[model samples]
Target chain A: MSSTNNQDFLPRSQKWLQISGWLLPFLYVLIVAALYGAFLYAPRERVMGEVQRIFYFHLGSAWNCFLAFFAVALAGVLYLVTRNEFWDHVAAASAEIGIVFATIVLATGSIWARPIWNTWWPWGDPRVTTMLVLWLIYVAYLILRSSLPDGEKKFKLCAVFGIIGFLDVPIVWMSIRWWRTIHPVVIASSGGGLAPKMVHALMIAVPAFTVLYLTALLLRTAMHLHQGVARELNQAVLERGRP
Target chain B: MRSLKLIWILAEKDLRLEYRSRQAFLTTFFFALLILVVFQFAFDPGSTALREAAPGVLWTALLFPGVIQLNRSFQLEKEEGTLHGILLSPVERSLLFSGKFLANWVFLVAIDLLIVVAFVIFFNFSFEAKLAWILLLILLASAGFSAVGTLFAAMVSGIRTREVLLPILLFPIIVPTILAAVNGTQEVLLRHQPQFLVRWIQLLSAFDIIFLAVAFIVFDYVLDE
Candidate 1:
């Protein structure tokens, strides 16, 4: 009678997954081309020289990371309110993706910083430290979920943590302001923001990263659904044999 | 109204149990004291360096004992299955949270007092800033921590890697409180700037309110088996 079971959910979404998976590579190619045009064909940075080229992917990755975590916090709230396994599954997937992209954001920032600051690492920088903390919070979150031996308890505990652990996000973001306020090294803001050329590069790259994010989230959630179905089926078969 | 009574009951129970056995309380106190002594030796007595680092050193002293006490807070309940029993009771689950919060807050207060007294003797810092405000900051910070701690403590009770995971989960979120408390206490110590203490106080106070409110509203979900 229940058409909403995990097994049934998979067959319907299978086609969408297949389509996105195939087109993802092409999308990446188009994004890289647009990015190339923005950075090279557009115009050159008058001040920072070639080093400013990292802006496209940097802001793009950072945006995706922020959205990934924002999704986790939103999913967390939904999970707490509804107490559903699907929400928890979606949350876990989003957290893993967030962690991956956050790492990339840090990596690209380091590469950018090296040329700009002459240093690969900058401690006490608010965004960097906050992102690192965000990484750790979700890392422990994943660990907490995995340790529960794959049962209802695992889902419930993770949902609770997903909701609570996000309290660190804003604090992490504003820590620089609250503590030191020296990070970010703002080049400009608003109408005076990144040069037209750099802005054009970001427009291409941000959507590129977003497309990648959606594709990753969908694929990961589908995989989790598949494994969960397999587990339930195995449990059903085991119970029948026992009887 | 009833919740406050329940909280006091739980706090008194923990205090009575501690008074009899004395293991948990003394372990925490000794652990904190040893760190203070270590800090004394680690830095030169007459050096201006130690004075500069006093906030960090004092915070470190409080943090070590805080973790130790928090780790032990749930041990008795877990062993006897009292936590589950408590959840199954007719009392509201949020009351259960309040009960734990109060008990742990008391433990922390006792520890804080001992540390502060020892801090004055060992570190040679003056406490003339404003005793009432300083105490208020400590209470607010402790309450925030105990609220979050109780929730995490319950979550970690059934897990295998709780001992290590608890700190990993709790510390990053509470960093603001520690910073505010440490810096606020430093302001109290030096008497250089009084206005900045208000900001730190506001920060810690805001954190305390947020954690308390969240913990109360969401704690029922945590008690679900």
Candidate 2:
């Protein structure tokens, strides 16, 4: 495990660790500031009241969720072009974090919807349904990754899926939007313009969540790289021990 | 022109194999029939509620059995080791995707017609001129379904959990197809809404083009060993 070849892996892994080490304290402060911005800084909604506070985090997570999935597709394209395993790690890590943010988006959206929309799950809302479908697609991507053994085949196949999944998103949203508009359900419109103060809170919360997503993506990707190196070392040890 | 012939030859090869055995064909049709029967029993058959829900039932029957066919499309190739032989040949990867997709689309459309007939009978949809619209919906929707399905089936062919994994990987991405298909069927059969049906058909056609192109481009990676 400690061979000279293994030594080459160390610095790369440590570089990521060192970067995250510096970023972690900043992430902590940013998150605290974000929570403050959400709970106390943003003005309470006149209509939805205190529960509407969830919007800041929800909107932030929603923004980053789409961004994360875009990263997955971008990484997939890079991996295909370069055949570099690093992009696969980026794809995988982005997908995992994307699912987390999507879950937050759905959960927060659902919680907010209960009082405002008068339903926990609004099937009539295109954006809501689109997010749900997006969540399911990436969840399937992760499942496909788990089912396959680790190799070029796994990376290549996952990259293909990531690209296809992202491409499907816009069409899914459009179709659902059309479906909902035709049916014309009676849900309240969520579209009124936001106040300037509320926008300021969102600006803070969005960057805070964005930073958090980056930190998680970096850490998870570094861990995947470490796992790859460990597997190679383990294989070498087993082969040397045999016969 | 020669490329088209090559693609047709590849598709014809799979079609000929299936035509010879007819195993997947019979089983897939029977499975689709069973789904319709199961739905009939689950719902109050011949009731107003059942009429309302028939479009959902029809598409569900159509969608689920198609997965079986998709899985088998590559499973047969993998089992016979023909995939390796095909890969060894100097065929373009995109052409290979089109050929496999064409075979799957043809198989799906054929079986989907039978399932639609069975659906009409079980759900009490009349044999009318509007049924032609249903047929068109089947053609467009199956094109999109098979495009994505062929790519994914090739992807999961080597994995152990492919049977379960294929649908999990497939259904979400194909939600637009399902929504459009079911709603289009409803517009034709229940509502008599030609204008709305046109919109649904447009969605299906758009989905078909987008996914077919995507699957064609990305298929090179799925088969890269």
Candidate 3:
């Protein structure tokens, strides 16, 4: 029974590992190309200069951050409907990755803002405030995840939270936008009309970061499955030794 | 008809129990009063800055102490093992959520009224007809606050750090409600125009409806054994 259970876990994890292995070199090449596109190819803007380059990675991370959160909500709904542990794993892993990307988005935005907007944090910008709230909500999701022991109960609760958090994002954005209108708008809107090379850099950078997120998600989910297998095997060994 | 009655029964049971003990009621009220007093000290009493911040101060007092009541809502059920008994009942789980949400909403509104009165006296705002709008804002905001709070309180009830975890989980999702509530109060009390009051009320109503529906739908999963 123990050996069969171990084998049951192996094929799925092995399949994910194999896929990630194939993607690894491709991911590497994409990252190199993306770096080249962002740093050397994209022209320095007339105003922000070298600091403007951070927008490539920042925008990429921001896009994937929202994408990863959407995946979390989708996985949550799938888990609730299907009652599959795999979807729960997907939700957990996606939430973790989403948080990492959100942090990157906030940090990069702040770093860029300091030089360009002349402030480290601009509370008046709806996107900035909304992103901060988004970060807090997901961090709370993680905290809720950690405080509970591993079980179906934990998964169900986390899924509920994940879904609710995702639903609140748009409402948060709207309310913050309205609230900002009442106050003085602090940060001027970043000038639009990107240069074509800049657009090309952004296009590459977005896909590269997306691929990175996928790789991280698959590896993390596989790790969780392996950890479960390890725990089960350890329990089996202890039971056998009892004789 | 039966479901509504069942929800009221559940809510009434909680309210009756609190009316008997009155521990949570008194402590939560005093805690809110303390927050109001602390703000008074933090900002100069009756100064223009304090007047400007009065709406924020009022909502802060109203919101933070409400957490104590929410935490205790489930803590009592858990302590007596009544939660399991309630779960084993024939009641629909969503109805169970409504009952809890109603109890919380009613409780918060009651406590907040006294706090608002205290706010009026401390801040020296004359009780006027416009104050009635503040009452309406409290009612709408509490509906949203209680809807989300009861759901989260249930989610975290089984955890050890539920007291801390509940607020962290709750505050972010309710930012819109807070903004609407504070600004709505500002319009009624501080500003003369009251131009944006209708807009804020609309936002609050939307928040209450959306969250109440979402909480009602997702609640079945929250209590499943």
Candidate 4:
């Protein structure tokens, strides 16, 4: 109904193939098993009790958020060099997913921190501060994209910001890491500093979350593709005046 | 030699324009002064607590008004359409960015000195050797701030609400530099031992180098059509 979504003008018979049907179902099963592994199979913490369970989702979300934003930055480079619409769509789609995952990371992180640290937020934690800044950067990225009308200008501007924002992560980390915050480092070079069961839970949880993020990105990209078709159709009709 | 001279020429052009109009110079200077004055009313200037907190107050006063100068720096070029002219010239995009960055750094340094003087008098600080260290932190932090700020300013200059957008986009990116500047200033001003001063200075210098390099390389995308 909206001007942005006038896709009915296109013939409806062009059914697009979606998902590797059996593979889709398989992923859902794996995700369910991951949930069980996290909640049921994973051993309880002697120290923090049930509150520590939030770490599984929190850690997974954190990993996926990093991956998604890295894609945003890579999309930026690809779009700049190739000037391809596909890369731009990928960048936009990943940013939407990245923000959602970042929110999950922050929300679950605070929940875990409350019972463990007796605080809702630890402002000194470098990881939390860095993630918050990443959120702002992507929010600004989305705003900058929408502010400009459809043209090379928007693509160029958004791409520039996407790259800049990603590159900033290390510097933010370096400065904030100097603070002796109480945010514990779980996963390190030797592996996660946790029990075997907890490590098992994390290994399953991270893979499943990766699947979720990738699926969400694929769906979002498909929606953008449809929108692009409709936009092109709209322009053509305006040019012809009587199509 | 050629690149350095080009940077000088471009920086001189901005300085000359500011000299004639005096818009940014006057506004940025007074704006910083007003921030310090407003802050003075909030705290009893003679108290030890206020003196302990002086470094943060001084840097905030300097940085908030500095954003205005950054925004104005590019707005003038965009308004006059000289930005496009500069983009089309034979010079490399990174070199052009360096020039703009140099001019912005100059503007920030000039205004910062004024703030330091005003800050010292209003806060009742001694004119000590430590002032030199504080000034060095200012120089290093200003380089990092303006390097990124100049790049973001150009990106936002073409937008309709750039006055607001510039700060939103620029502030988060420069957090490290601001942290370093404040901490380093704190060591110089508030502490007797000043143990962390060297480390904070190192952080600021490292921040400047990394961002300056990134901004220089990424600037081509900002200007490229």
Scored by DockQ, the top model is 3
Over B1-225, each residue of candidate 2 has an lDDT whose tens digit, in order, gives 977988999999999999999999999899989988988888775889888899998899889889999999999888888989888898898898899999999999999988888887777767888789989999999999999999999999999999999999999999999999999988888888789999999999999999998888888888864
Misplaced by over 4 Å in model 2 are: A1-10
Q: Tens digits of per-residue lDDT for model 3 on B1-225? A: 999999999999999999999898899999999999999999876689999999999999999899999999999999999988888999989998999999999999999999999999999999889899999999999999999999999998888999899999999999999999999898898885567888889999999999999999999998755
Give lDDT tens digits, candidate 2, residues A139-167: 99999999998888998999999999999
RMSD of 2: 2.0
Instruction: Name the candidate that leads on lDDT.
Output: 3
DockQ result, candidate 4: 0.60
How many angstroms is residue B36 displaced in model 3 relative to the true structure, after the best TM-score fit?
0.4
lDDT of 1 at A40: 74
TM-score of model 1 relative to the true fold?
0.91
Clashing pairs in 2: none
lDDT of 1 by residue, B37-132 (tens): 898898899588888777678778877678767767787887877877776777788877777778888889888888877877887766664656
lDDT of 4 by residue, B1-225 (tens): 998888888889998898899888888889889988898888875788788778889999999888998888888887898878877777788888888899999889988988899999988888888799978988999999999899898888778988888888888888888888887787687764455777778888888888899788878777644
**In candidate 3, what are the lDDT values of residues A130-165, reduced to their tens digit?**
999999999999999999887779889999999999
